[model samples]
Target: MSEGGIPTIDIEDFPAQMGKLREACEKWGCFRLVNHKIPLTLMSWIEMGVECREIIKVYAKAVHGVGMEIAGKLAESLGIISSSGESEEIFRDWACQFRINKYNFTPETVGLSGVQMHTDSGFLTILQDDENNGGLEVMDNSTGEFLSVEPLPGSLVVNLGDMAAVWSNGRVSNVKHRVQCKKGEVRASIASFVLGPKERVEAPTQLVDSEHPRYMRL
Candidate 1:
């Protein structure tokens, strides 16, 4: 874990860092990722024109690949799938939703809440937050208090959502988070959500036993 309560995972350290990634999902429900697949140039292009649907399409495809890879790692870390490459099938066909948000803050909005605290309904979300402004906050699972998430340059934020908890059978954390207005400036972010499976979603047999039963079916 890092000093800020969120863990940092480097994509370059994959398979080897599966333990770290699993810990982040179960403990923090979120983490800061470095050395991800998305290029900084692509991020800049997306930010330059949020209304450009063509650019968004390309970005979504790239992000979807990363999301699936992360999902496979999660499965491997949980012991649900072995290293024989079967983990990739766990969420190979899951859907993705791309979103770009721009917040134009004014004098009246300073020190106010930008987005209310809530948990995402999808399986997971990959976020590229603004590098300049700081307003994101996540609830600390240990202390039950919201902590500010400072901007980390060249890093992406990953948040596990409600469906993650459902799929993990209560093993993973589905945390609450929100955006605030710390300064009267514009803020923009790109979010890619990997929703639950296309078919029904249920906890794997390995995770549902006597001690750890299935929590819900969706």
Candidate 2:
């Protein structure tokens, strides 16, 4: 974990990566996923599994794919799904959306907010932030303070949302965050939200027991 408690996951770590994935979800609720760029040699394996780079050239579509994959892996990390079992069908027919935003803060609007403070309403959000411009912040619920999220280039930040909190029986963190006006240059970011099914989103049976009581009504 970094000084601020946000762990960065390195995909090359294999099984250990899975362990870190679980810990980050249970402890920090979010983490930065590094090493997302696929190796050129994994082409054959990827063709048999998740589709590779050719389909990912379309940035928006790629972001959506990555978000869905991360959400699924998070579920597996938490024992909500098993490797041998079929992918959870909850997200199969649910509503999902992707957004791209460009914020240009002029001198006149300096110090003003680019985006009001709020929590996302979905299950998970994967964001590709601008490498050069900085203006994002995430609240540290423990300290009751806002911390700037300055990820390195080629890294993506994952944030758990309201539904994530409820589904984990309030185990995972759902941070409050906002953007501030920092510079005149336009800051661009693309975010894809993997929303919960409209019917009902509830904690898995294993997550709710005498020790971890159910925290939300589905």
Candidate 3:
């Protein structure tokens, strides 16, 4: 829970938290989420599904679909959605990438990067980071420096991706992050990405009104 700048959002107080969520997205492009409706038991089930390699993708897609609804509501609070309440449905159509990464410690691979620095080239990513192991870091958009993201137990980290930036007409922040294996420990994380439309990605007309002109076409 030692998130230096990123705020922690309580989903139970969704309406109350929308403002904070919007600020987090606009500034940090990522935040720690708590009070999520999902139960710890379900999370354990997802873990089991991963181990069984049977229902991992299905479960990830279901989680991402729910996450997208939350995102759309957040967008609504910011007046960034379409004229009708269709943004959530539209986002559900986006391609999903469900993946789990395993970082195992090796004596020969000391001081190697687990993941290189890069921005998520999608709309959003819901990550279940390792509760014990932490090597994730995100770049500060203003300072041009990287900040370490510590592990928060029983929390999901939501990151706004490239398509989010474009869809929000540049109001949203697209975070850049990388991973390092600081300790000789095995770390595992699962992520679900919501890629943009099958046709083309664009900001909704409501988001590009006079007050907020379109920023990125794609």
Candidate 4:
């Protein structure tokens, strides 16, 4: 695992690595992934004009739903807390959501000539970028510097969010990132988030040990 607990693995072995993954989640709250088998061809097909717009849209919606559910479960399992101090509102915005933003390689649209930096507003984010294209950059909280993240073919990038850190009692951290368009190639990325529950107190679960938990609901 890297500084942020990012783990890369073959898609086929994901199930076998669940134990390690759970440990990573408990400790670092984020992971980088490789060989997830998302298929470069499919990714390419989606980027080749508007032919796959409908498919992409549907997939995005599904991703959002899944993210929300996952957030709720994470909250329930981790004993998430709400910013407003109301446990009933745990399923509200502080939990989970998805954001999909795409931009052509142009100076005007992205506001920074070709790149834009920002942090997501969810507990965890799952990102899929254009195959063979490079643009993602993440900030290293420890060093207070930005690091260029190379795009890996058929891989997904995952990051923990602010709410997650709060819910986990500062154990996790939300990463800052930016996207730069490659010369002559448009950039496209899909981001799905899993957030903690709203209205719940932001704290780690006592039932589960602070260092190693026996069970993680999400």
The runs of at least 3 residues in candidate 2 whose Cα sits more than 4 Å from the true structure, single-residue gaps closed, are 1-5, 38-57, 88-90
**Worst lDDT window (10 residues) for model 4?**
79-88
Query: Which candidate gets the maximum TM-score versus the true structure?
Result: 1
Query: Which lDDT values do the candidates have, in the order given?
Result: 0.86, 0.71, 0.76, 0.56
Best by lDDT: 1
**lDDT of model 3 at position 214:** 77
Write model 2 residue lDDT over 101-193, tens digit each, in one string.
778678877778999988888888887777677778877666767777784677788888888899878878776778987777667776778
Off by over 4 Å in 4: 1-6, 9-29, 35-45, 48-54, 61-96, 107-116, 198-201, 207-218
Off by over 4 Å in 3: 1-5, 45-51, 54-58, 81-86, 107-111, 209-211
**Number of colliding residue pairs in each model:** 0, 0, 0, 10
* Reference-based TM-score of each model: 0.93, 0.81, 0.86, 0.61
Query: Tens digits of per-residue lDDT for model 4 on 1-218?
Result: 12432445333453465455444455444556655444455544445445667766666665554444434434443444422133335545544555555666654444343556665655778777666656676776556665666776666777766666555665455566777655555677777776555555445455346465533232
Q: What is the C-alpha RMSD of each candidate to the true structure, in Å?
A: 2.1, 6.2, 3.0, 7.5
Query: Between 1 and 3, whose lDDT is larger?
Result: 1
Model 3 C-alpha lDDT per residue in residues 1-218, reported as the tens digit of each score: 13365678887775667778788899889888777766565565433334655556556656776677767766776676542256656665678788877888665555678899899998888888877777888888778787888877777888888988987888889999888786787778888788788887777787777877778767
Q: What's the lDDT for candidate 4?
A: 0.56
